[model samples]
Target chain A: MQVCKKCLLNDNMPSVRINEDGLCNLCSTQYESRGIVNNNEEEISSLIKANREEKYQIILAYSGGKDSTYSLKMIKERYDASILAVTFDNGFLSDTCLKNIRTVTDNLDVDSIIIKYPAKKIIRAFKYIEDGKFFPRQSMERASAICNMCIMLIKNLIYYEAIIRRIPIICFGWTPGQVMTSKPLIKLNYTMVLKGFENIKNIITSRFGARYEKYFLDDAFMRENEANMPYLYYPFVKNNYKEDSVIEEIKEIGWIPPQNTDGNSSNCLLNSYANQCHVSKFGYHPYAFEISNLIREGYLTREEGLTKIGNVANPCSYKMICEQFEKITG
Target chain B: MNIQAVNEKLKEFFENNFLYGESFDDINGDESLIDKGYVDSIGIISLVAFIENAIGIKVYDSEIVPENFDSINSIYAYLKKKMNTQDKAV
Candidate 1:
C-alpha cells in the first residue's frame, strides 16, 4: 500500500509517474505549468461568472452515488447556481442511497427528480452483460460494456430533459479517472456528437447486434442540440487529500452514507462486482488510469489508494451481488 | 487513385496502426471490423482521421455514421461513393 506524496491517489492506480522528487506528473505538468492553482480565487470567480453567463439551469446527473452527491453539494454551497439534482432511478437503488439522496438534497434545498427507466429492458441488458454475450471484447468486457450502456442511456435521457427544460449545462460528477479532459469543458458541438454517436454505435452493434442501431443511436438529436455547454470539474483541483479526510469534510455538508454499505461503496451494490470483473479480466479496474493519474499528481499516497481498492473484495457484498444476479434471472 | 490502390492503402494503414498482425489476405472488406473484434472506439476515431488524411476527401461532420464507416471495405466504398458524387457536382 503506497501513497503518492502529493495527491489523493494510491499506487494501485495505473499509468502514474513519480518523478525523482516524488511529484505526480499530472500536478507537475498540468497544474504547475498551466499555473492553475486551486487557491487562485480570481479563477474561481471567473469560472462562476462564466457559468452564470451561460444562463444555465443545470441538470445535475445524480445517481445517489458519492461523487454525484458531493458534486451537488459543491454546486449549492460553492457556486450557488440554479441546480436540479436528477437521478436515473435504475430500479435497483438501495433504500439507503435513496435515503441519503433525500438527506443531502433536503439539507441543501436543491430541487430533486428521479426518472425510472423501463425495468424489464434494464434487466435484459444487464443479464446479457453479466452473462457475457456482447462481442468485440477490445473496448469493453461483458460487465463494463453493460454498465457503460446503462450510463449512456441515462446520459441521453438527461440531454433530452435539458433540451426540454432549455437547460444548457448538464453537470456530471465524472472525475478525471472516469473520463479524460483534453478540455475541462466545452459545448457539445454537432461534430463531437456525431463522432461520439458513431463510436457508440460501433460499440453497441459489435457487442449487441445491428438491430440496436435504430434503438440505441441518437445522432440526429444530439447534433441538432449542439450548443456550447461546457462540462466543468472542481475535483480537477484538490487532488491532494486522504480519502477519510475528504469524506469527513464533505460529511460536514450533510453528505452521509447510504444504508447497507461500507466505505468501498457510497451508492451502488453492483460496483464491487464491476471492479472484480475488471480486475479478473484486465488485471486492473478501468478506473486504474485516473487513480494512477491522481497518484502521479501527488494528491494521494499509494498506500491509501490501494486500501480503497482492497475493499473491493468484501465477501458479503460479493455474495449479495451474485445473489441479485440469480434473483433477477430466476 | 485506382480502386486497387485505394484498397491496398487501407490494408497497409490498418496493418500499421491496428497492429493486429492480420494481413490483407486475412481480412475481407465487408466483414465488420467491430463485429470481428479487430477495432474498437479508439480505433474508429483513428481510422476516420486516417481515411480523411490519406484519401484527401473530408468526411463531413454529418457523414459520420455506422453504415458509412463500419469496416475498412465500407470506408473505402464510402470514400469512393463520396468521390463520385463530388466529381459529378464539379
Candidate 2:
C-alpha cells in the first residue's frame, strides 16, 4: 500500500522499489536511459513526408476519445495527409461517443469505418480477464481488462487495414505511459512478438469454446506482408500540448467528452466496470501507472493523477455492464 | 564471440535490465524465459532492441521465432550463427 512520493506508483507494482528519498526505482534509474520523450516533430514530419505519395497515407485507430479526436484533427488539418479513421465498436461505446465520432469525422471530412464485433465475443474476452487468465502480471502494471483486449483488437485491425490498403503508417492516440514499456515508434516487424499472445488466445479459446482468431492478425498475413508492414506511430506521446489545451482545441472540431465513461476514458462505457474488476483483483486501478507516468512527465500534477484514478464508477454503469455481459453470454 | 562470452553477456543484460538486478540462479539455460514468467511480450521487444544495439545485429522478423529466443541457449546460438554469417558475408 506504500505509494511513491514522486509518482502514483505503489510498492505493489512489479519490479518497483522505493528509496529513502521516496523516489521509486524507475524514477531514480538514469532518466535519459529511459528514452521517454515527447512529440518528435522531426520524426513525425519525416514519416508523413516519406509516405506522402501513398494513397490513404495513414490509418488512425480512432476511438472517439479526446486524445484520438485530437489526433484525427491533427492528421487531417496539420499534416493534411489522407487518413482512414477506423473505430472498433466493441459493443460498449456510449451514445455520446458515437455522436462525437460522427460529428468530428463529418466535420473533418475524413473517410471513416466502424467494425463492430459480436457482444458475446467481447464478453468472453472479459470473462477471461475477470478470472485473471488473459493479461500477464507485467501487463497489469499498465492497463486493465477490457482496455488491454480492446487495444489488441484495435492494433490488429489497424495492421489489417494498413496492410490491405498498403498504407505505410499506423498512428495511435496513445499517451506516453502506454508506450513507456516499449518503444513508441516501432516497425511493424514488432508484430513478430505477438506470437506471445497465442498463450492467452489458447486460454480464451478453451474457455469460450470459440476461436477468436479474427480478432488477431494471422501469421500468414504478417508473413506475406512482412517486408512492408506499416510503421506504428504514437504522435501524442511527447506533444508539447497539455491535455487541457488539446481538449479545448478539439472542441472546435465538435469533440465532446462522454457522460458515461470512467474518469480515465472518454469513449468506452465498459471502462468503469473494467476498472472495478481490475481493482478488485489487483488492489489498484490499471491506469495508475499511466496517470503516474503523466505526473512524472509534468503533464499532470500528483494530486490530479491521484484524483483521476479515484473510484468514479457509478452503480448504474456497473449494473449496465453486468446486464449487457449476461445478456450476451446467455 | 564464444558461447561462454555470449552467455555471460546475455545473463548480465537480462539481470540488469529485466530482472531489476535480481540474479539468475533459478534460470536455466534451456528453459523458456517467457513461459517461466521472467519475460513477457514487451520484454521480448526490449530484448530485441538490446540485441540489435549491444550485439550489433539486426533481428529480422523471420528470425524472431521461438527457436531463436526461447532461452539463453537459443539466443546465444542464434547470435553466434548471425555473427558467423555476417563475418562470412564480410
**Residue A210 alpha-carbon offset, candidate 1, angstroms:** 12
Considering only the true interface residues, what is the Cα RMSD of candidate 2 after superposition?
A: 5.4
Number of the top-ranking candidate, with lDDT as the measure: 2
Residue pairs with clashing backbones, model 2: A38-A238, A39-A238, A39-A239
Q: Over the stretch B52-71, how does candidate 1's per-residue lDDT look in tens digits?
A: 55544555435655677766
Residue A23 in candidate 2 has what lDDT?
A: 82
Q: Pick by TM-score: which candidate is best?
A: 2
Q: Give me the displacement of residue B54 in model 1, in angstroms.
A: 25
Worst 10 residues of 1 chain A by lDDT: A31-40
Every model's TM-score: 0.63, 0.83
Which whole-number lDDT from 0 to 100 does residue A222 have in model 1? 61
For residues A126-158, write the lDDT of model 2, one tens digit per residue. Answer: 766664555666666678767777777787788
Which 10-residue span in candidate 2 chain A carries the lowest summed lDDT?
A30-39
